[model samples]
Target chain A: MALAEPPLGRTTAPTRPAPQKVWVERIPPIWWVLGLFLLTLPAYANDFILFQVFGWTFILGMIALSLMFLAGYGGMVSLIQMSVAAMAGYMVAIFGTSGIAAISMDLPWWLYIPIAILIAAIFGTIVGALAVRTEGIYTIMITLAIAAAFFYFTRQNYTIFNGYTGFNLVVPPQLFGIDWRQPVPFYYLTLGWAAISYGVVIYVSRAPFGLALQGIRDNPRRMAALGFNVTAHRVAAYTFASVIAALAGILLVWQNAQIAPGTAGIPAVIDILVIAVIGGIGRPIGPFVGALIYVLLRTFSPDVLLTFGLSGERFKLLIGLGFLALVFFSPDGVLGLWDRWRARQARRGDPLTGEKGE
Target chain B: MKAFVTRHPTWSLIIGFVVAVLLWLIFAPWTEGMEDVLGRKRVFLNAIFGGVTLGALYFLVASGFTLIFGLMRNVNLAHGSLYLLGGYIGFEVSERTGSWLLAFPVVFVVVALLGLVLQNQVFRRMEGEELRQTMVTIGLSVVLADIMLWIWGGQSYTIFAPDWLSGPMTLPIVSGYRSSGEAVMLKYPAVRMAILFAAIVVGVAMWLILNRSRLGMLIRAGVDDREMLAASGVRIQYVFLAVFGFGAGLAGMAGIVGGTFQSLSPGEDTRFLLASLVVVIVGGMGSIPGAAIGALVIGLAEQLGLVYAPTYSVVFTFLIMAAVLAFRPQGLLGRA
Candidate 1:
């Protein structure tokens, strides 16, 4: 089950039927209009909403994509992915030109980013090495313990992490004398990084390593017998995911203008898990869609509830109810449902394929 | 005798403890005024006491988690939510009735009923699907926590115990050295002692029920081979419901004791959940003695770490987990 080896060399050969021709005809014109409307939303949306809501969502969604890589493809449900990202973010703040004993002593941007990303990847590798031994719930628990350990350490140690306040040391540097924090600039920056990450993820999902990882997921014993080295693949997946998360971490610090323990604590970690599942674990685009929904909900729910004579904190109740409903009704999440509907329409339009009369 | 010693594990445990105590005594300072200033003697006693009390809470919660894991093979992530909900229910009940005794049992029963309903309605539908169950339970946990937040608000609450248990009491043990070479008196919290007693009783009862009863026999059999039991016409679903309810009830009991020991906050649910998960993982799942040992080790480590390395207390727990996982992947009491 080596994931039907990626059609790499045959990319231009048309070895298989094009997926678009099979499914695109079934989608209604209204759906196309809806897609167009969404694509044009940034132009109409307010700056406050764009910068605060959409910007934050993109950053968080990228982090969730890292977790989605592990849980959906690698069959490793970890709770420490955010902690790893936070670790990297904290490192940037420590190494950048703000802390008392900055690691870089004002090192150049090129040197700092690579060092932070490397450290995060190494940390993720160690966590994966420890985690790959256990399966199922044990992996979750171990990762959680690691995250909890990091959270407590960051909260208490003042010298390195700047204690509870964390490091408010770093902000996105001005490139070519342009302040990147502006809504449109920051949005583009985030969107560019997200697109790069999504591209890499899609490529990896079709790569040989990804195929082997999927084989391990489907049946580890069988894969192990076939000399696939399941544990190594899992650790590699984690390392790869950590690289993506570290990139997101850099963007996150830029978005927030600070790195605090709260950024990487248990709640934030769980929120990433929730975002990944909500977006739909089946595809990379799921994180973006889920993030959009979450960001909208979080931003508007409080104000909406306040208008309805309810306290803003009560908005969590609504979110919780919505999450449970989503899990119960659509375990594959919104994307899964959308895919099913599209397939159904495609089949209906083509009676031959629908009725097995082809 | 050598064979007997090797076969019976208790002999090795006794030997280990004796050697550990001897090492501690040889290393521990015994000078006048040193104990008074550093309070090392009292600290040791306090740490042990804290460990045991915390271990009791861990036992209550982890036992349920392990039981559910053993019987249903489903990691009930919502177990912590049930514990938190139990605390909130007890808090509300006590506030309304002005009676702690009535509040405790009422909360337990209510949570048990909730557990039963959840098993019948939600978990039963998710049989044989571990990942789906995880998501559903996690969703349930989030929903429950949010509902609790809405109902209880974000303020931390403390339960009031009886007057006698509220204050610290001086114990008869006089083991510390004063400046003038006299023994100094030490005080311990009476509530902690009470919790320890409750934990021991619960442990003993669980041991007896799990080892000596017919229901326990069926549970053990089912855990070993659910398909076999199903083929044999045994009602596995009923057993699952019972196990789930009982585990939830145990968590409720732990919550009441924990609320009294530590203040109840909205966030304590996840904290305790993590602690319980750590315990069950370190301890062998489905093994009562394993839970007890795991809880004690974690409890002591946490207390000692808090005293010595407050910043790295959680690291000690993780270290233990990593070590255990590296060497004994099935846990101390788990069958290989």
Candidate 2:
């Protein structure tokens, strides 16, 4: 049941007596190229590409990353990350301003943002508390049921949730004399958060807490016998993941300029799971890869479908089929495929020195 | 039951008190004060009946899900799709043939066949991989849901009960006294009552087969220890296939029941899926009687909450689930 990834091991240099310590030299050229391209994308890319596609990808990636944090590291495949995000979205709409004047308090951003994240984190913690009571597969079922409950509750209760219509015009605040919701600003906003989320998750994965969580994932009884509080670690992982999801939710609301119960609907919740699984939950970077693929498919599948004389609405069908194919062929998703390919290539000897490829 | 009562005397007393109060509420004619406090007796009675009938439907859907999960350890997320597919098929059959009874077996067989194919082809390939199987089912459900929507569209469909089951039947229980002191008995939809009766019959039959029959014994043994069952020379795959087909068929039939009680639409699949999940969670996964009890509690909570507190009815169901998970993670009747 403990689907552990390969151990993170550091490689020693063969030619040099001492390992190099330059951080920049340590970073691969591919990362520098990718980072440079992303950083300068707003300069040339259209508003749609910068705002809608990449922004959506980063937001979704962050949420899915939270799920990966749990499923990949904690071995708890929670479907509640989307709901937590939606809860933050709803809290922002309620505490700050929205089209629903009667409901919105119109608080300052400084006040509402913290409050929203806090509330969402609390909600996630409570759900995590309830969910962690069970083990393994039950986690999925319980979280899904809880997620459905949240959706239904939001749809039903009008006083706070504003009923089915939800809140509109829930745009981000204009900060530092700049409209953050603008394409360029929003792109950077989401990208910054996505990077922070990615970095935090990566860093924490190696931290003692994260290592302990992973240990608990592999063997809870053993962890417990070793004096680690298994339940507390699991719950803490949820809280950390929820903060990431809540941040993503706020950014998502700003990106969409509205919030609704459908934001956390069963389909949406399931979509987050699909995104995490399709990308590969084995690594922190996997969710972003999956989200990018998902966003591309979602954004462009309509035209592709239309070319085949099919309706645009068949995008879901396409996604479903693609998902099914991935599940059947590559259970670990695109990342798994990449890993296997890398493994195969590494087995091949280098042409010049006849040495095995790294 | 006697041993349980003796083992937990306090719990037995509390349960006894609650049951006695509920019986009194049902049988004893409400006074004017009582009516003023708790609304009309008819409304209360209707809510009770509504809850019970709804519970019947929940039990039908959830029992199959529990059985499949209990034995196969395959969390078939596509189960809800099977239910909806059955309902659509049932609707199509009943509509074309003009015979409500004719739809049941046809829908059951179709859905059951689909279940067999899935078990044989899809799940068998990923044996012992519970998470992967679940993911596949999730994928299957998404595909099935879209395909169903493509065919049925977004409009809701309700199946009509036959003439024999259509009108409301007056029960002996007095709802209220008329101005002239004449007793006004309770009148409930006959179709609902009949469906409730059918559900009860189905439940009893399943319990009987599981408890009394050899096949049931084999299934139970498999549930307890699959490796042992297979080692004993039984064709465990066939047993798995049969159980899966039966569970899927039962779910499909429940879809028809649900359509009759309410209506079927695209979202109903997810709705019923969540319902079954909550029922299984509360009742204990793989326990039929647990499903029944869980369904009953949830159904009652939903109906009663809807009547008394419209906004928070969902909270009641959720609270019940939360309480169960907190107190007994295995569920109310689940084994530790």
Best by TM-score: 2
lDDT of 1 by residue, B1-336 (tens): 477568977968787797698456434545657666655777766776687788888988898898899888888888888888888788888888888778778987999999999899998987887877877877777778888887788899888877777778776666466779787666788888888888899899988888899888889898899999989998888888888899998898788778888988887888888888889879987777888989988998898788767777777888998898888888878877
lDDT of 2 by residue, B143-243 (tens): 99999999999999999999889999998898999999999999999999998999999999999999999999999999999999999999999999999
**Candidate 2: residue pairs that collide:** none
Consecutive 10-residue window with the lowest summed lDDT within model 1 chain B: B22-31
Clashes per candidate, residues 3 or more apart or on different chains: 0, 0
Off by more than 4 A, model 2: A1-16, A350-358
TM-score of each: 0.90, 0.97
Runs in model 1 lying further than 4 Å from the true structure: A1-43, A99-105, A307-309, A350-358, B1-39, B169-172, B178-182
- Residue B289 error, candidate 1, Å: 1.6
lDDT tens digits, residue span A1-358, model 2: 2347543343443545676669878889999999999999988999999998999999999999999999999999999999999999999999998999999999999999999999999999999999998877899999999999999999999988988999999998888999998899999999999999999999999999999999999999999999999999999999999999999999999889899999999999999999999999999999999999999999999999999999889899999999999999999999999999989878887767889986
**Residue B250 CA displacement from its true place in model 2, Å:** 0.6
**By DockQ, who's the top model here?**
2
